[model samples]
Target: MSAPVLVFGWGNPSRGDDALGPLFVEAVEAMKLPGIECLTDFQLQVEHALDLRRRSRILFVDASGTARPPFEFQPIAAARDDSFTTHSVSPQSVLQVFEDLEGRPAPPSWLLAIRGDSWELGTAPAPSANANLRAAIAAFTAWLPDL
Candidate 1:
């Protein structure tokens, strides 16, 4: 059977701070918890829509400059956007595509935003970014067991 929860994280690891999403994936994978599936990519593409299929719940993780603290979690609803036609789509757009293809509503989904400052090309995460990543991982570690 498919896992009940899917954690999908995407970001460019080579960019400073932008690696938060995929790093979060790595941490979660290490836990090897039951009924949870983890996925990571450089970016959210339209092809990723299929990942939502057969999931009971979904979490989309990324680094956000405007988000606060360790991380921010908010419910996501499937909604079609003009951007859906593009190759690189947002999590919401991916959900919309899932709905379109499956002819049904998507599972409950949340977007997890880990705060980050710099995301320059070809740089390691800054010290402050590492702090944020640690906090986010801790926060999710606590949250995951309850799911």
Candidate 2:
């Protein structure tokens, strides 16, 4: 059976802080927790909507230059947006696609936006970004048990 919770993270690992998404997924994978399926990609695509199937909850992680420091977690809902026309879509857009394809609402979802400042290609993740990542992981772990 598919895991009831899906953690989908996406970012370009080659980019500095942009690696936060995949790095977050890596950390979660190491935890080896039950009932959680982890997925990482360079970016979110329309096809990712299929991953929502059979999931009771979903978490979309990404490095955000605009998010508050450490991270921010907030509930999301299906919404039709301009992102649908782009190759890289947002979490809400993916939820909208899932709803469109299934003719039903998607599983409850949230965005775990990790704050990131740098995005230079080929450089390693910034030390500050890594620190924020650690904090995000801690917060996520604590909140997960209540779910």
Candidate 3:
């Protein structure tokens, strides 16, 4: 059998909107899809790259602070200079690490970002952010069947 797909959700659960990534991963886990593995954590790291080596594909979910509006969810492919100096290692960097560690086939990868606000402790998402979360959940749910 082929290796399973990995869905990795990265973010801080203690921080308000930052938890969205993990939350989305939780939603995915609850679905219990066969041949897919779901992993959620506070952030991406070099260790995570090594852990994904056996998978055939990876879907990374996170909350980002780009120019896009709140709750924006988009799929991203690998790119040059993708390191995140402000946060944990970038997804692209992780993929690179995987390539270095394993000489064989590297898994296909994609990134999904949810626009977020209010990273303060004990705070909840604002109205707009909640709406975005709902949309993101819907979109992610729709993609689960095909995986």
Candidate 4:
């Protein structure tokens, strides 16, 4: 059986601030929280829909260049948006694929977008981005108890 909650974080670790997503997953994994599973990827793909099965709640974490300072957390739903692709997709696109495969709506989901200012390849994550990541992780940890 799968965990009741799924936390999927995606981003390229080689890219400066883009590494926030995977870093978030790493932190969560270290927490060793029970009943929650964590996964990380360089980017979201259609295949991730399979991971959504048997999950009660899903949290998609990503580093966003346009997000507000610290972070942004908001509910999301399955939608046939332009972001759908086999190589790279959005959280909503993944949810849509899950629904398409299951013939029903996907589990409730939310996106936790951490603010990122730098994304250059082969560069270290920016201090500001790391700070934002810390804040986002703390918020998620607090929210998990109510899940």
What would the TM-score be for candidate 2 when compared with the true structure? 0.98
Q: Could you give candidate 3's per-residue lDDT for residues 1-147 as a string of tens digits? A: 334888888888877888878887788778787887888888777777677866867888888766265455445544445464446788877777677678554577777788886788877765666676678878877776766
C-alpha lDDT of residue 30 in model 4: 96
Best by TM-score: 2
Q: Residue by residue across 2-44, what tens digits does model 2's lDDT show?
A: 8999999999999999999999999999999999999999988
lDDT (CA) per prediction: 0.89, 0.94, 0.74, 0.93
The C-alpha local distance difference test score for the whole of candidate 1 amounts to 0.89
Poorest 10 consecutive residues of model 3 by lDDT? Answer: 71-80
lDDT of 1 by residue, 1-147 (tens): 679899999999999999999988998999998899999999898788888878989989999999987679899998888886676688889999898899999999999999999999999988888898899888888777667
Worst 10 residues of 4 by lDDT: 81-90
Worst 10 residues of 1 by lDDT: 80-89
Off by over 4 Å in 1: none
TM-score of predicted model 1? 0.93
Runs in model 3 deviating more than 4 A are 1-3, 70-87
Collision count for each candidate, in order? 0, 0, 0, 0
Tally clashing residue pairs in candidate 1.
0
Judged by whole-model lDDT over C-alpha atoms, candidate 4 comes out at: 0.93
Candidate 3, after superposition: displacement of residue 51 in Å?
Answer: 1.9
